[model samples]
Structure formats: structure tokens, C-alpha cells
Target chain A: MEATVALIAEHFNGALSPTFFELITFANKLKIVTQAKPTIVMLGEEIEEVANKATHFNGFDVIAIEVPGLASYNPETYKAVLKSFLEELKPSFVCLVQTSTGADLAPALSVKLGAACISSVQEISSESGRITFLRSVLGGKAQAVFSAMTDITVVSIQPGCFERADTGACSGNVNVSRRAYRSLRIQDLGVRPGPGCDLLLSEAKVIISAGRGIRQKQNLALLFELAAMFSRSAVGCTRPLSDSGWLNSGSQVGLSGAIVSPDLYVACGISGAQQHIAGMQGSGFVVAINTDHYAPIFNHSDVCVVCDVIEFAPELIKAIAKYRQVT
Target chain B: MRILLCIKEVPETDAPIMLDQASRWIRDNNLHCYRMNRFDECAVEEAVLIKEKFPDSILDVVTVGPKRAEKILLRALGMGVDNATHILSEHTGYLSPFITASWIAKFASDKDYDLILTGVISEDNMQGQTGPMIAELLSMPCATSVIFERISYEERLIYVEREIESGARHCMKILLPALLTVQSGINKPRYPSLSKTLRAKKLRIPVICSDALLKVETRERPELIRHPSKSRQSLILEGTLSEKALELAAILDKKSLIK
Candidate 1:
């Protein structure tokens, strides 16, 4: 039997998530490492349209499991359905997006199948007939390369790490199967919109983002003042600031919040954790001002200014004002 | 109600960490400080809140790590956990999530706890696996990234709201005897009170060596640990604060970003 690499598709509100395409990229990498046939497994209600869309990708066999009552994601239903099907298929590898759902499911699923489970895998390589997975550890200060010992390996691929795979002109066949899901213990009440729905951050041309290094909640005024200097600028923040209730949820940027690609992104006091970096890395011009010279955020920036954002913000504004008058 | 909160000791978030010789793991000797993981702090607070509500509830906090990990357990105790257990692994290097989960599950199974709690993920490994894996090992329902939870003792269920992508919340209900990996911001963890700290110092926490648990071999082994290569070549600004600011402003002006 040919080894199979299963790419678990993530969908919500009747649309495939961007992570689905990223999972395809992961599948492509696994093909290079294991020479396995790629298979896409999608679980949802009335997912035939998304399943058909997935089949357009070349060299992938699609399995669409429709559980009638599961309109939204229920971990219990997902685990129950995938467990029975994957046990029979016995895929050599299973790939999931490194999100809340994937992180929760992968390890538990591995326990059921007795497979090796690795989370937040950023890179994969095969050397001398052995495959190794690379992941960030110690808050992205270091990377760890891991090798699996079990027959089947389950991995959660980090988002924004791999480029989306191109389907080109070729397509593949999809097999749609309906499964009955009965969860007496858990029920999905659908998704509820969170508070703070400001669209300013997403629409702004320039974003001045703050992080924990901003020191105190009162210091946020410095960021706001700097942002007001520009015509179409907005104040944004990392998860910590928002978690502290200093900013609304809408102004937050990271894996669990808005992904903005502004014309210019000025990170003030931001340490540039992976989650925050994933949200703003696509900005056209990136500048990071931080007190810590070794902050990881500098690695992703175009210009790095090592200074306390509190002191530097006022000086930066003065410099900009002086430069404008001179020009 | 008996609640088991799983916590781990990790290097302080801002601690300077370096790759060890042979490039396989971090150099522990150089790390000057350690504390309860920030995410696990939320879990400990949540369990404490539940204990506060029940008043009769027993909150048992457990950690798996070397001797240095006992400090975090005591810290959790100082935050109001009723009891503490430490699974002494003795080694500081990378311990696979599977082995950790297996050890935790073995310790938790016979206790018949009403609920198990853990952090969404650790600051060190950031795997976010142990809670759900322990649940699976014990055949219990599990929830991850739970931002809010309300326990209904009468109904024997817990209603939880899990944070998903794009700030969306997925509300669900799970039966008791389940596991929840809590996300940060659920609650503000309190500082250790003087009286509680004094009391915790006198409490004797039983240390169960991991060797006493069912022997589970790690299925995944870390082969290397190194600094991540930067994708962009960032030009670090040089000189004093104002000089750097002026240089940055010039660059921004040249790009027509600031006018």
C-alpha cells in the first residue's frame, strides 16, 4: 500500500480558511520527504462545495465527511469522526494547521492512534533517508529539530511559515462520504462575534503598534499621538496590550486577531513575538522601536531603532515635524 | 469538587536563553530566573476562582519537571491551590509532550477529579498538547483555548467560550470530568499573598518520581536547537536616541511614509 499524507482542511462559515491552502503547502513538503500520496480530509456540514474546490488541487485525493448537525466546529465531533476514518486509512502522516483547533486535536488524536505528534512545525527536511521537523521553542529564542520514532506522525504546521501550494492546471478526484456524528457530551452553539469591531486598524494606511514594552496603560497616549501625526494612521497593539484592556479587541493584531497589511507599520515597544509578527509582516515598510536590542521583532523589520519607545516617540515626532518644516 | 490544574515551570519570558553545546537543547545553567508560565497563570487563577465559588472545592496543582520546578508549585500554592504534586523528571532538557501527558494522566486517573485544567500552551515548547492528550488518555472530553468557563454543579456540565481565529468565540458545553486548556486574559492572576506564602512554605508537597509512573518512551526526539535565521536583512539604526530617531524619520520621509 502506498503511504498516505492526510491534510486536514479547516473551514468556517461555509468557506475554506486560508490555512487550508497552507496545509496544501505542508502536504507538498511531506511528499518530498516521504514520497507519499497526498489526501485532503475535510469535516463540516454541507461541505460538498468546499470539497469540490479542494479537488482542483493536483495530485490530491479529497475525502469530505459531512456530519449533518455539525455546522460549526465541535472538537468532540471532529475527533470522533476523524478517529474512526483515519484509523482504517492508517496514513503515514497527518497534517493540521497550528491553531486552537489543530493544537487541541492533534495530540489527542495521536494518543488514539499511538502516532508521534509534533506541534507548531515550521519546517521539514529529509536527510539520509530520515525526516526531521523544525519548530520554535523557548518563545522563538531557539528552534528545535525533531525526528519521529512512531509509524504514523501527526504534525501541526504553523501558519505563515509555508507558501501556499499552486494547483496549476492539474486537478484531482474527491471522494465525498457522509458520517453520522452523535455527541451527547458536547454541543457547538455556533460562533459569537466578539466585542470591539472597529474597522480603522484594518483600513488604515499607517499603523503604530504597541506592545508590553509600552510600560503602562497610560503610556498608550504616546503611541496615539505619534499615530495622529499621519493622515490615515491608526493605533494598534499586540495581544498583551489588548489582554490588559488598554485597547479594544479590534485594535489587536496577531494570530487570533486582525491580519493587516498596511502601507507602513511602526512597531513601538513591540518585542515582535511570532504571533504579532505573523499579523503585520506583510506591511510595505516596517520600522521597529524597542528598548531591547535583541528583540526578535528587529529580525523582521526594515529599520530597527533601539530606544525606549516612551522617550523616542516624542523625539521622533519632533524630528518628523522639524524635517517637514525644512523640506 | 476536585480540580486538577497542570502547571509547568518555564524560563521567564524575558530571560536570555542560549542554545547549548551540540545545538540540541537550551543551556539551562545560563538561565537566571524561572516562573510559572504566563498561560498557566491564567489556568491557576481560573481554578482558584472555581475554588472560591465552591468554597468546598479542592484544587490540586501538579507540575512535571526537575527540582527547580518546586518553586512554581509553591507559587501556585501561594495563589490558593489547596494541595500540590510534583512529578520529578530530574532532567532539564526537552521532555516530549507525549511523555508529560502520559505521566500527568497516570497521576490524575485514580484521583477521580471533576475537572482538569492547563495552560493553552507553554512559553518554552508552546505545544499546547498535554491537557487534551491527558483527556484522550483518560477518555474524557477536552476543550482548548478556553477564554471563559462557567461550571454548573447541578447539571454536571461546564459552559466554555473558546477563542478562535480573528477574535471569534466558539461557545460550547462539555460534561464534567473533562479537561480545559485555558487561554490568557481569562482572569488576572493574583500576586502571592504574605500569609498564603507563609503557609505554603510549611506545606509538604509529595514528589512522585516520573519513574514511578507507567514507563512511556518519547516517540519524538529533538535533534537540534539553534537560533532561527532571519528572513529579512534589517538595517539596525546606529547612535544615540535622537540620532536614531532622526535617521529613522529621514528613512520614513524618503519612503513618503511620514509627511
Candidate 2:
């Protein structure tokens, strides 16, 4: 039998998450690097639908572990179940999505199996007969390439980094396994809804978003004024502003907040971290304004305006007004 | 209750970082300023809050880094940590999260701490693995991205709210002697007090050499450090502020984005 590369699948609201396909894509890439069979292990209740969908992908073997009591995700149960099962398999690599659950589970799992655990892996390459995983460090300022020395390596693949794995005409085999829920130290209470839906942000055609660069809460008025210039515009911000209580959580745009793909995204004073970029990368046109010329946000932007947002916002607003009146 | 908080010192986020000559790691010479990891500051604040609530609770902060990392430990001490331990690593470079966790777990094993806390992830490395890894090494239950937590002393249990993707919150209950990786924004971290700073300055914190801990084989090694590729048509607009703004307006006008 070929050495196995296990992809841990996560699901939300009964359906396979969109990221699962990304995980499959990641596993497919890993298959090339490690020369191992790609397998997906999904844990949840009523996961048959997800398992069936997983088998449709090419070059993957799906294993659905159904624990009826696990109606929701509990780290302790996840650790307990995966620890015993993975130890027996002793796969060459374990792949997981770099989400909250994966971030929490990968480290603990590595300790259990004594395997190397790498998180937020964005790229992989094989050089000189050794496989290495590339990830960002220093808040995306630098990238670090890591090679695992252990027999078994666990990695959390960064979402939206890889192309989706192509599905072949024929489906692969999927194995269904049932496990009784052993009493766990932690108990899951399901998910509670967060501050309503962000319909304003989602529906806005133009979004002017602020970041720590706004400096103070009062400066947000400038972003709002900029947004008022457009008929369908709305104001938004990065995680720090929301975390600091300067903006409501609903107005926050990032991986943990709303994922908005407005027609025009004006990122003012945002450094363009991966989490913030993931949310707005799908925008039709992006304009980044910041004082620092090397802000990573510029890398993803179509128009990079290297200026202090506080000083530039009013100038841009005046320019827009003058241009509008003349036209 | 006894709580152990793990903090890390990191370069300011905006600090200019460059790859060394060999391209193996970042050059440390350019790092003129360092502070506690932003997430770890939240962890320190959370531990301090817990200590405030349970007056009798003892809080200890530990860090695994070189000599310069002592500054973050002192900051934690100034924030009300009763004790400080520095697991000193003489070498300067990327230390694998595995080694750091191993050293912490070894030191914590005999300390009989009831709770271990750390930031959800380090801002520099952004791995978010050390806390949970320590829990696994200690065979304790663990939670990550914890935004809210409440302890019930009589029941010896902790109720926590973990923030997942898309702003959803997962509420769970864990038994005591557990570990938690605190998410940012859980609380506003208080600045180090002047009095505490004066006292902390006079106190000598115990430092343990990395060699003192059992040598755990490093399982992963970094081969390269470089900047990420630009994924867009980054057309940097040049000229004065007004000229740039006019250029932007023209682009938007061409796209019919502006009326």
C-alpha cells in the first residue's frame, strides 16, 4: 500500500465547506511532492452527503467517521478520535484547512503522534529530493520554507492559495466508518449566531475600508465621507479597528468577519494582511492608499496610492467633487 | 488557582525586515525595537483579569527566546504576573514552535499549574501552535481562539467561547488543568504600571538555558525566507497627492464607476 496523505475535511451546516475543495487541491499538490495516496477524513454527524461529494473528486479516498453525539465540533472529541485513528494509520502527512478548528487541532495532533506540524502552508516544492512547505512569517512580511524531518507531518493549508483539484469523470472509493462517542472532557454547545447579517456591506457596490492607519476612532468620519461620495458606497474597516471598538463588528471585513467582493474596494490605511486580503481580493477594482510605500496591500491592489490616508482622504474627496461638478 | 501565561517578544509589525546574506533567516541587526506579541498581550491581560477576579490565584509568565526577550517577561511582570521564567535560547534565528513548546511543557510539568494560557498566534511566526502543542505534551484539554472564558472553581470546569470563521462563536465546556489560546480583542490590555515596573526592575527572574531542557529532535527546518510574490497588476500611481487623486478619478471615470 502506498503511504497515505490524509486530508481532514471540515463541514458547516451539513454541506461540505467550499474550503474542502481547496483542501483537496492542496492534497493533490502534496501527492506530487510526497508521492502518497490522497485520502480525506471527515468527522461529523450526518456526514454521508459530504462523503459522497468528496468521492467525486479524482485521486481521493474519502473516510467519513460518524460520531452521532458530535453534532458540533469539540476540540477534545476531535483530538481524541483523530489521535487514535491517525496513530494506527501512521500516514506520511496529514493535511487540514488552516481554519480555526484546524489551527487548534493540528498542534495537539502533532504532539500526540510526535509528528512535525506546520500551519498556514501557502506553497510546496520538491527540491534536491526533499519536500518543503512555504508559509508566511512576521505577519506576511516574510516567507519561510520548512522541510519536515519526521516520518509523519501534519500541515494546515492556507485557504484560497491553491487551485481547486480537478474532478475526473469517475468517482473514487469512499469508506464510511462509525465510532461511538466516548465521554470527552469538553462538551460542545453548538454555534451561536453573531451580530446579525452584514447586508449593507455585502450589497454595497463601493466600499471604503479603514485600518489601523486611521489612527483614531474620530478619523473614521473621513472614510464615511469618502463613502458618501458614491451612491452605493458603504464604510468598512479591518479587524483592528473593530477589535478596538472604533467600528462595529458588522463593518469589519476579513476572514473572521464579512467576506465582501464589492465592485470598487478602497483600502485606506490598511497594510493588506492575508486575512484582510482574502475578504476583498475578489473585488473588481482595488485602490490602496497608505503612507508606507511597501505595504503588502499594494501587492494586491490595482492602484497603489502611496500617501498618508489622513491627509489624502480629504484631497481625494475634494478632487472627486471638483471632477463631478465639471462633468 | 495557578495560571501560566506564555508570552513572546516580536519586532514591531512595521519594522523593516530583510533576509540575511545566506537567505536563511531575517537579519536581526535591523530590528531596533521589540515588544510583546500583540496576541500575547491579550493573553497577559486575560490572565491578569483572571487573577484580579480570583485574588488568591497565582499567575506566572514564561517565554522561550534569547536575552532580548526578557523585556516582554518584565512587561508581563509589570502587568501583575507573580513569577517569570525565561527559557533562554542562545542562538538567534527561527526557533521551531515544537522546541519552544517542548521546553515550556518540560518546565510546566512539575509546576502543577491549573491553567495555561497563550496568544492565539504569534504575530511574527503566526503559527498559533505553541499553546495547544503544550497542552498535548501535558495531556491536557485545549481550546483555541478563545474570545470569552469563565471559570467555575467548585466544578473545576471552564466555559469558553471560541470565535470561528465568519464571525460564528462556538461555546464549549472543558475540565480544569486545560490550556487556552486567547484571541485578540478579548480585552483591552492594560499598560504596565509604574509601581509594578519599579518593583519588577529590582526582581531577578529565573532563567533556564535551552540546554537544561530535554533535547527534542527538531522535526521541521526552514530552508528559505523571502517576500511573497505580487499577485496583481500593481500600478503604483506617482506624482503629487492631487495628481494621484486625479489619476484615480480618471481611472474610475474610465470604468464608469463614478458618475
Candidate 3:
């Protein structure tokens, strides 16, 4: 009997997370390499609609398990339930989006099931004998190819790595069932709203973001000064600035912060880590400034200035202001 | 109360990467240019904060790496961890997260720590697995990406705000004897005091050989390392500094991005 490749469906408060379809598409790619088709495991309290929603788009067997005690994602409840469920099913590959939830679940699940766990997987290469998965390392400065010798492997795929499967029609079977379990050590206190994303940043037509390349916290003032030029503009920073407490958490932009799609984005001194690139990639026009010509940010920008961001910012600020006055 | 904090050393986020036709970042010339994993610094800071509140708390920091790994341990001690352990790993390149977690778990299981904490993920691997894997190996409840936490001393519950998608934080209350992976930016990590650093330097920290311990070999291996194709390539403006700046202004104007 051959094993299975499975994707754990994601839902937030019973509404299906958009990443579910992307997971389906990634799993489909893995299907060709592993010679095993993918199945969808939908678990939560009231996931019928989300599961039904999934089957509508993706044609994979949907195993919808409603655990009576789980209203929201509690890692303990998830590990307790999914471990046995997976043990019985024995999937060769368990795939999930590399969201906070999946990041929490996959490693523990892998340990419980004695499976190998690979995370933030961005690409899959099949020509390399044993289905190797590629993921970023050194903050996306480099990439690594990983493969599992174990029978079971759990992978968390980074968002935006694969094209999402489109929504259309339900072609697969949806098995709706209930599982009985009570969480012992963990209690889900539901969710409180995250920091208010300043409307200035979220609604900005022109957004300027900075990173470590700014040299120091004082350089952030330069980024702000540059932001003052645009009619509707604001300033943001990458995780380093946020982590250093140089800027408030609200102005941070990345997978963990604001995901914005502004009309124009100016990235200064930012190395363009994968997360930061993902956050700002949706911007219509992007210009990046950095000292490191080989900086990964250059790959994602529309216009790249290979210079120290600090030196370029003041000049660009002056140039833009002067140009605006002339025009 | 006893707390166990797991730490890791990683390449500085800004060092020029040496990538070959390549998979992993070859840490050849850049071996000396590394520091404590940024996220783990937050974990150590959080543990220190917890200890400050509960003065009776005993905090221990541990790292699984080579001889150079001790520097991070000493730094943790300087940051106010009560003790440090160096689980010396022989393999220098790409030790599996599972193998790392198992060894740490083996060392931690009998210590009966009331709480355990680790960085949400290592900056290099970004797998974010060791903390949760240790939690599983020890059968302890666990939480990941924890940004804020409080101990309800009398209730003996830890209330936490775990970071989720798009800045949303999922709150949870976990019973004691649990594990948490601390997300960065939760707090400003305190710099090591000179006195503490001197004291930490004088202490004889324990170094346990990883091979001496029961082995949990890696089931996964790195087959190859190569840079992925870029999604987009920027139009680099070739010129002097001021020239590039003027060009940027023109480009933004051309794109109608400037008002």
C-alpha cells in the first residue's frame, strides 16, 4: 500500500484562509514527483462551509474533521488530534502554508509522528532523484535543497511561492465527520485585534521603507523627511528596525506586519528579505536604494539605485522636491 | 521556578553570502562574522524579564553547536541567565533541526523546568522547529511566535499573544510546564552589563559532547544548493551617487509616482 501526500486546510474563525488553495497547488506539484496524489484535511469546529468552499475550487479528497472542543487554533488540541489522525492515515508528505499556525503545528506534529519536517519551502525540484525542496537561507541571501529519507515529511510552504489553484467547481468527495477530544494544557482565548496599521501607511499613495542599511536609528529620520515630499506618503521599516524598537510595531511591513499594495513604494537601505519583498511586492512602482549591489532587494524592484541609502535619500528628497517645484 | 531558554548562533543577516551553483550559504570565510540568532536574543531577554519579576526564578540557557557556540552561551549568561550549557555538536554544516531538538530535549527532560523558551525560529534555517519539536519530545504544551506573555502567578497560567497573519495576534492561555517560541520585537533585548559579562566569563560552563549523548540522526539531507530565479529584476541606474538620485527622481516622475 502506497502512502499519501496531504495538505492541511487553513481557516480563520471558520472562514477558509486564502492560502488553502495555494497549498493545494503546491501539493499538486509534489504529486507529480512523489507519484502520490494529494488529499485535503480540513479540521475545526464548523468547517463544512470552508471544506465545501475548498472542494468547489480544488479537486482533492477533503477530510473535514470537526473537533468539538476546537473553536480556534490551539496547538495542543491540534497536536493531540492530528497526531493520531496522521498516524492512522500515514501520509508520506504533509504540506501546509508557512503561516504562524502552520509554523506552530508542523514541527511538533513531525516529532510526534517521527516524520522529517522542512519549513518555508519555496520551490520543488524533481530532476534531483529524491524530490528535493528548496527554501531560503541566510535571510534569502542563499537557498538550500532538502530531501527526506524518512517515510513521512512535513513541509511548510512559504506564501507566494506557488500559484494558487483557481476556484471553480467541486469535483472531489467531502467526508464530514466529528472527532472527540478535550484540550488539556492549552486554552484558546480567541483573538484580539493587532496593532492599528496607521492609516497614513496603509492608505499612502507613496510609501518609503528603510532597513539596516540606514546605518543607525537616526537615519530613520531621513526616511521620514523623504516621506514628507509626497502628497499622501508615510514611512515604514523592516523587522530589524522594528526589533530594535527604533520604530513602533505598527509601521513595520512584512508577512508579520502590514501587507500593503500601495501605488508607489520606495525601499531604502532594505536588504529585501523574502518576507519584506513579499509584503511590498504588490506596490505598482518600486524604487530601491542600497549599498550592496548584490542585495536581494534589487531583484524585486522596478528601479534600483546601487548606492548607500543614507547618501541617496537626502539627494533624492531634494531632487524630487525640486522636480515637483519645476513641474 | 526554573526556566530553560534555548539559543542558536547564526551568520549576521547583512554579511555578503557566498552562494555557489548552489544550495546552502557556504559559511567559509564568513565563519567568524556571526552572532547570536536575533530571535533567540529576544528569547533570552524575555527570560531575563521573567526572572526580574520573579527574583527566585532560575534561568538556564543552552545552545547546540560547535566550540564557537559557547560565545552565545556566555552572552546569554551576561544577559542574566543563571547558567549556560554548550552541547557541542561536531558537524559544522547544516545539522538537522530534529537532531538539534532531540539533543536539547535529552538534556532538558530531567531538569524539570517549569517553563521553556526559544527564538521563534533561527535566522539562517528559518525552520522554526526546534522549540516545538522539544515540546513534543518532552510531551509539554507549546506555543510559537509568542509576542507578549504574562504569568498569572496564582492561577499558574501564561497568557500570551502569539503573532498570526497580517499583524493579527492570537491570544492563548497555557498551563505551566509549557514551551514558548519567542518572536522578535516583543521587547528590546538588554545589552550585557560589564560586571555580568566579567562574571559569566569566569564561570566554568558545562560542555556536553553531542556524540556522547544518545543520537537522533537526521532523516533529511541537503542534496544541492542553488539560487532560485528572481521574480523581478530592477532597472539599475548606472551613475555617480547624485546622478543616481537625479535619475531616481526622473523615474518616479516618469512613473507618475511623485506628486
Please provide, for model 3 over B1-259, each residue's C-alpha lDDT reduced to its tens digit, 9 standing for 90 to 100.
7999999988777767665443244554444477899889999999999988999999999999878778889999999999899999857567888999999999998899989999998888878999999999999999899999999877889999998886788999999999999998788899998999999999999999998976777888787766545666678899888888888888888888887
How big an interface RMSD has model 2?
1.3
Q: Is candidate 2 or candidate 3 better by lDDT?
A: 2
Chain A only: list TM-scores of all candidates.
0.95, 0.95, 0.93
DockQ of candidate 2, scored on C-alphas against the true complex (2 decimals): 0.78
TM-score of each: 0.97, 0.97, 0.95
In candidate 1 chain A, what residue range of length 10 has the lowest lDDT sum?
A189-198
> What's model 1's lDDT at B12?
74
Ordering by DockQ: 2, 1, 3
lDDT of 1 by residue, B113-226 (tens): 999999999988888888889999999999899999999999999999999888888899898888999998888999988899899999889999999887988899888888
Residue-level lDDT of model 2, residues A230-259, one tens digit each, is: 988899889888899998899899888988
lDDT of 1: 0.87
Worst window of 10 by summed lDDT in candidate 2 chain A: A163-172
B1-259 in candidate 2: lDDT tens per residue?
9999999988777756777647377666535578999999999999999988999999999998889899999999998889999999876677789889999999999999899999999888888989999999998999899999999988999999999887789998999989999998899999999999889999999999989787977888888888877878989989998899888888888897786
Clashes of each: 0, 1, 4
The best-first sequence of candidates by TM-score reads: 1, 2, 3
